[model samples]
Target: MQKIKIKGQDYQLPIYLPDATLGVARNLDSLDLLQVGLEGVMVNTYHLIQKPGEEILQKVGGIKKLMNWSGFVSSDSGGFQLFSLIQKNPELGKITDEGIVLYTGPKKQKKTLFTPEDSIRMQFALGSDVMICLDDFSPPKANEKRIRESVERTIAWAKRAKVEFEKQLQKHGFTDDNRPLLLAPIQGHNSHKWREFCSQELQKIGFDIYGLGGWPLDEQGKFDYSFCQKNAELTPKDSLRFALGVGTPENIVKLFFMGYQFFDCVLPTRDARHQRLYVFKVDPKNLNQEILKKLTEENRLQEIFDYTYIGKGKFATDNSAISQFCDCTLCKKTDDIAQVSKAYLHHLFKIEDGSAFRLASLHNLRTYTLLIEALRRA
Candidate 1:
């Protein structure tokens, strides 16, 4: 699965998709995304349906036409967002066997039923290249009884989602080879027994891809690599694994080795807007799959990746580009008079200019794409 053809477009695998949750990446356009070597993006079905609404997207011929983006697009089923909302305040919604019941209006009286079938239908309307099925997320601190309930509900929802996916495929006239890929997440938190059960059942039901669902963090909020490693092993050797909402550069490197091929995260773009910039610690030219593989094998990730706080006072006087290895718009500026140097970028942020967000985002995204390029070559 080194290369994938989606919506008649070809893209390399082990790819990274920035969160363009609402058809647009913040402060950047479609061309801006393409220029930085982004092959695709992960959009949120929950947000798009609220803002522009479904009718407009269908009328405009989907999100691609509305944004004029020809790149690959993956749509999330909004399970996690709904889960987060409900977890924070129980009054907002509740996850039922039938569907998700969202409470709205001034007093939270209005109710809307969002089922797994509805998720697939909305994804069809969005014209997504990859569609994720809605799954009940296993809470991190759940006991056995709660974890079991989540696993049961997740499988039930996936069964319903599969039925709807087939219906949408026939209705939309998509054939086997040309149809969008469907992915189902494996739930049950960190419980190996339930997680393995969830994996086997989902495999029996079948899906084009399997997702690493649930929070991949510990009580201390650090990444739990053992949990991720076990999840990948639970799936079949040939399955295309998608690590949803995962993570920094080192996390990506480690997971890629564990057999995951797809990833979507808000870190790079979100970090960019927050003035955190990723930079290769070593010479970019020396970087290759073999080199990266060796580093991971030896657990030398810190030697391979690092980031700089561009908002720091020291960078305000630095004359260098954000990253010498970067070929982004801000990094590759040739003319001396208009060079997008660290000093210039610092000034933009200091002045609170809008361009600062776009410029910083370009550099960070290019950093991720560069890493993806190295991984694909292996």
Candidate 2:
């Protein structure tokens, strides 16, 4: 496991950060996140500017202050959000080397230029512990030419983002010891050649961390481990890598051994809200490096990892905790009071109660933290 300091706070590697896209992790409050043992959260720079807007964020002294959160905060460059919007409907905007040109207003004629420099500046204003550079995402089925163009643009943008990042550090009077970490995503779709090239170029510009950019899913929507493995290899042995938007419990455990130390994804919390909760078939406390390695090596992760869909009919009358291993509020009793049982949680969801979301989210996130605990030991 790796350990690093961000803005004077300590963080152990192989850490997971849930997405709080707009400075909030959906139904849960900041204290709830801390209670679940989460070390940090990833916020979106794109959505924040659209919602609370920059004026309010700066006035309130950034997201940490705005949310009254004390945990580490990582900010997305907002490049993916813009790219996704344009990809869904090209008439919305276009990607130029200079930046993403988005067409706003009723007629879609009003133009807004969102550049790499703008992303860094906004993230600094948000006072994030880790800041990602804006990058062009390569589509899975992108042609050879398109993939090459994506790599070129990603490298170019990373260069500009680095310049802006340094400028911001100096402006804010931050030193190397106290400055936030900067990450640049490597975009190459499935092409190892382009991915390697992107990595080499970004390394020359020298980003603090390299992100696994683009979708790791194959054309058939299956998770592509080879794609992730190749991306990890592109960076140096000791370099830090962020598995951006990567999935599932199995994915996290598998990727951790492959040399990725940082991860941020929406699966755990999102799945909780959707009534699908993750659980370990065996207690995570029983896991260790040798056992986990044996399971990974023998392709037995499925045996140890599983999920509980709280909405199922069988769960409607089940009185057990969501997970026997989970210490979340819904799973663990407080001062001998009975914890919320699976049956009660199922009823909460059945009746459309908002507390169901919060309770489920807490359980799921706790489950993730438990896994993180086991991995750190590994």
Candidate 3:
């Protein structure tokens, strides 16, 4: 897919959406995101509902208005977060065919049910351009029976979500040409049998986008490109595919060629906060799809990605910019003016200053966006 049209706006495909999970991209504001070339962000419905609540969001005119951003916004169903909570602490909630039932209180007895309809309603209130359907997240180390159960629940919930999505389109006066796009995730852990089954069933029901659900990892805990490739093949060539929560720069490049056009990941921003910065070993401006494809064919794409640890002792006295090639505020080279110095970043992190976080985040986000720019050209 070259581009995806949602709510009358067209976003260039093979794009990377930074995880602005709570309406903000951590230390960076909307302006900062724009400066880094990010045209879209992914927010979590569960957290926003809990914090600002849906009523406040509606009154404030959704997240875009709340954040003063005009870029594309996609809202995750928050099923992943709920699943994570229950998996970490079974007392928090339980997932059933009806929906997720939460028990939150001092003694874990306060009941609250979150259904597919509830997810759809919340997305509408949030005014998300792209809304995700609530799916049963495949837990780690799940057996065949557990995987099959997750797939079944995912399919059932998707059917409910589709019905509710239609209800929302009508309630919000969204016409067929202006309606928000809804995506359904296919879940089956790593089982091809159930993955195929889930995909076929969801295709019959239909959706604007299909997400590669569950973890994209193998038994040995390595990135499973084979699984992602297989999932891409399960869908039609013209269909839009979202590789949810995926992954490193290399992962993005590989998956893009595999026909996955949309991706959301926390690696760049999250890694930046931890003082880890991504740098292109080769200047990205000098590269394009043909070069990248050649590199991939030669198994040399890994050479393009490198890292700089600002917190390392060696960087304490290094006066060079974080990256010589980056155009972010932290590393832009204009004549002889250096935007930011490695030594200064080291000092800021050493002193635990807040500016260190913002500067580092800007640089990392720019790196991801630069990679996306190259992918777009490809």
Candidate 4:
């Protein structure tokens, strides 16, 4: 019932798990760093079930109160994990007409079964703002028989998740004022025909949002962007289209132009932890001869940075201590990339410093939030 509007656009933010360890706590902390651009945080159902257990989270006032975050939150059903788990240990889990049965953890110690109804119940317990339906996924090279089986099961699961979510909402007296939205995922491998079939079928099932175009892109050593675009075209325009698990900056730009409204991935945060940052130039000439000279002296002058540097190896004009391009707090506050230097970050990896993780997480989050803002303006 609590209607959460992101960026004043009547849609939810698509930021996925901050990371594995901290969960919602990390997301809440990043909000300060993200400022007003922060909208929603996404959590993984499979990961949460393994670690904290949904019961514990419910006892702690659900994810939002536990993290003390008021914005929208979404949870992915454990479908993808089941698929990936099958790859690792084919015998680790079994799929039946009803649902999936799997073991959790390194020891393969605990056995748990997740039906579509069960997946919905778990999200309800977590009090997610959006609950995703369970869907079967197959990699690009999946056999025709396996792909057909998975797609059929995925459709069945979507029906179950939707029915259960509606029943639970009614039982709990959920209204537009405080009810969460439900999303259905479309699953099909590389085939355009199957992709269209899945999309058309799921659209009739009726969900507030839809997730499209997932599965291992690297198996073929290149992405099938055309397949993705075709699938996107098949989806209904009234509902939001989310491109799950793919959020490279360039890919995001391309997908946005292709009509995707929501995206989530670990690239920005993961890359920042490895000392990669995204920079954009307001004035091309601000990155002048002097800044290039300093960067050359430091051996940090890459062709990529040539478009953005202002001086002293700093990025973004606001961070230059002399110009003003970005208004982000990190750039406005100080010229201290040392506060989050590549050298210190690399040192952290070399020696495994916990502080480095925190810094990298912070900077990466900032980069993602800023990028989303920029995209919206454009």
Residues 1-378, model 3: lDDT tens digits: 287778888889888999989998989999999999999999999999997999999999899999999999999999999999999988899999999999988998799999999999999988998899999998869999999999999999999999999988888899988899999999998899999999999999999999999999988999999999999999899899999999999999889888888999998889988999999998999878778778877889879999988898998888788888898997876666567889988999989999988899899989999988898885
Q: Per-residue lDDT for 131 in model 2?
A: 98
lDDT of 4: 0.63
Runs in model 1 deviating more than 4 A are 333-338
lDDT of each: 0.91, 0.91, 0.91, 0.63
lDDT of 4 at 331: 45
Model 4, 267-312: lDDT tens digits are: 6566655555455434322443344345444645343221221222
lDDT of 1 by residue, 1-378 (tens): 377776567878898999999988888899999998998999999889997999998999999998899888999999999999999999999999999999999999999999999999999999999999999999999999999999999999999999999999999999887899999999999899999999999999999999999999988879999999999999889889999999899999999999998999999889988889999876655677888889999999798788988899997888888877777788775764336888888889889999989998988999998888888765
Q: Which ten residues in a row have the lowest lDDT in candidate 3?
A: 330-339
Ranked by lDDT, the better of candidates 3 and 4 is 3
**Error of model 1, residue 105, in angstroms:** 0.7
After the best TM-score superposition of candidate 3, give how far the Cα of residue 326 lies from its true spot, in angstroms.
Answer: 0.6
Best by TM-score: 3
Model 2 C-alpha lDDT per residue in residues 119-168, reported as the tens digit of each score? 99999889999999999999878999999999999999999999999999
Extract clashing residue pairs from model 2.
none
Instruction: Compare candidates 3 and 4 on TM-score and give the better one.
Output: 3
Q: In model 4, which residue pairs have backbone atoms overlapping below 3 Å? A: 1-177, 1-178, 1-179, 2-177, 2-178
Query: Candidate 2: worst 10 consecutive residues by lDDT?
Result: 329-338
- Report the number of clashing residue pairs per model: 0, 0, 0, 5
